[model samples]
Target: MGTFQIEGGHSLQGDIRPQGAKNEALQILCAVLLTPEEVVIENIPDIRDVNKLIGILGNLGVKVKKLAAGKYSFQSDDLDLDYLESELFKQEGSSLRGSIMIVGPLLARFGKGYIPRPGGDKIGRRRLDTHFEGFIKLGADFRYNREERFYGVEAPNGLRGTYMLLDQASVTGTANIVMAAVMAKGTTTIYNAACEPYLQQLCKMLNRMGANISGIGSNLLVIEGVESLGGCNHRVLPDMIEIGSWIGLAAMTRSSITIKDVSWDDLGLIPDTFRKLGIQLERRGDDIFIPSMESYEIQSDMDGSILTISDAPWPGFTPDLLSIVLVVCTQARGSVLIHQKMFESRLFFVDKLIDMGAKIILCDPHRATVIGHDFHSQLKATTMVSPDIRAGISLLIAALSAKGTSAIHNIEQIDRGYERIDERLRAIGAKIERID
Candidate 1:
């Protein structure tokens, strides 16, 4: 239970680099299991969830070596398939949501894959039906142990590719299915697949590993099954969610922060989405420069309607940054409606911000209306407990812009996403300290 004691009302300066994408790292790391050759990956973020996945891979007998900082080589020449049935494996696999993805690679490379029901943030009901259903469609036998709360998929007769139209555009589901289909007998087509940059990165990496995949940036993906896949080198993209968080932080604290090497091209709808909130940010080469300001104004629609920001699949705003968007609107000049379509519990964190004197109305589990203070009133710092990763970072941003010092406990949630956040913040002149 780590705590962050932050002194508020100070503007930050200097440049901060965004970490490698956590989501991409999870998918790419699992792809290493598909081939027996050495797969080298760079720009891996040092975070709790990612480290946990790597540890799980090591337990399953993948050869992992840290070549240098933020770079590693993984070889899956010999895997301990028996480990998947162990109690120790069950305990480890059940703790991470990313563990669900490993099942797909294992099922494709070997005859079967078994895993305990995966766990992660208590955001909402994230079912595994999509992943398993896709496997069953590809001629795999599926079984579930309700008493043990476990899932298993086996294709002892081998997998054959087929077309699948997903129930929903679930990111992990699409990644899982693609990995399974990459080595199937025939061609596989996926419609309504998630085309987020991270997912695209996974598909492109699979292509580099000798998997035939097309439609790189579109919802429709075509995969031609190959007999075997070879290892390849890949570098994960900069985390767009962290980049958005820093943008929000700079606005809330009136800081002039430059986020370097942000991969501006891949940040679809992120920059323009923040621009709708009237935040002034400039693109200088590959860097994003957010200037210090006393206040920013939220822009209404052309027809004089209140601005409504909602999350959707790729081209739309990312659900991960919606928490930061809600927080940034707290001090804006006008009001905005935040509609979080994916997770029901994400908007629940607004009550904590309200306690800090920000005016917010929680309409329901999925919707909230925020009336900005326009910097007329500063947030009153107080002690709080972090609920999840995105909400924790949003609360930290609020604390940084508040009138007094605030304590944020259970910062491990924040650590699961952001890498060395406190140290990075310190380098940028933020008044933050960690208390163990």
Candidate 2:
């Protein structure tokens, strides 16, 4: 295991570019399977989970080439269908949650998709019901092997488009259903779909490759079946979650950091959510400039009640960012309640913060009340293990803002999402070193 030894209270000052969107990359990379043509994608983040998916594709006989840094082309000309039943495939497919998305494109093109239990952050009950139910609605056979703990979907008769009203706005489920419906025989309408920038980008990319899809930025999507798809070049948007993390880090350590080429329009409700905690940031054309501040205070409601920050679907605060918001609020001027509705286990990481002298009340698995220290009291260094991706980054931000040095083990969780985080943060004058 590796650990990050971070010396806190250092003011980071530099221009740091956010890596490409990890969530979108997961979705977009899987979309390459919908066609046999060469789909060239740029700005692909080099991270563990992503690389694992790419390896899985290579094992499946997809020609993945690295054209340049963060640029690659994939051609699924000779997919190895039997490989899906191999033990190697099961071992690899179980390591990343993104593997679940490949099922859609496989079932759409090859009439079958198989996956071992997908592995990802243990934040909450991330069910595969929405995905399987959507596929069943679109004329696929779904089955689960209890002993092997595997999922399979097949449509020997071929997929036929149909209407599906999702139980909730599931990002992966929406992407899966879209990929499957693109090759269906008739029209497909998906209501209450996830309309995040990630899904929008997927739809746009598919359309470029000859899939007829409409309503890119809304909950409802309409897809007209296409015979086949060709390759297209796609560049993913900036990682909004990473951008939000940078914003929180800047506020916690009172640093001046400029994030370049951030797709501001795609960052729905992210900037304004940070502003709620009194973080001052300005947009310089396409860049976001967070200046060193003397003080930042949290904003309350109009009725003077303590503000409540909660996560919702698109155009609302993202659940992935609530961890960062909770960490940043620890140093704010007022108290706020954080409701992480999507995931039950995410808020449990705040106990590490409480150990470091922050005043936090863990109301339940989903809610927490944080009374800010407002820079009057500083977090003391402590040792902790990273639990998940978002929570891991949150702890890193807290460690950087603490008074002494903190050691965070299980940094592999952080590495799964953020690319070379310690190295990148060190470039921005942060005193963080990766130790094995």
Q: Could you give the C-alpha RMSD of every candidate to the true structure, in order shown? A: 0.6, 0.6
lDDT of 1 by residue, 258-338 (tens): 999999999999999999999999999999999998889999999999999999999889999999999999999999999
For model 2, name the residue pairs that clash. none
TM-score of each: 0.99, 0.99
lDDT of each: 0.95, 0.94
Off by over 4 Å in 2: none
What does candidate 2 score on TM?
0.99
lDDT by residue for model 2 over 259-363, one digit each (tens)? 998999999899988888899989999999999986789999999999999999998889999999999989999999999999888888888999999999999
Q: Could you tell me the lDDT of residue 13 within candidate 1?
A: 96
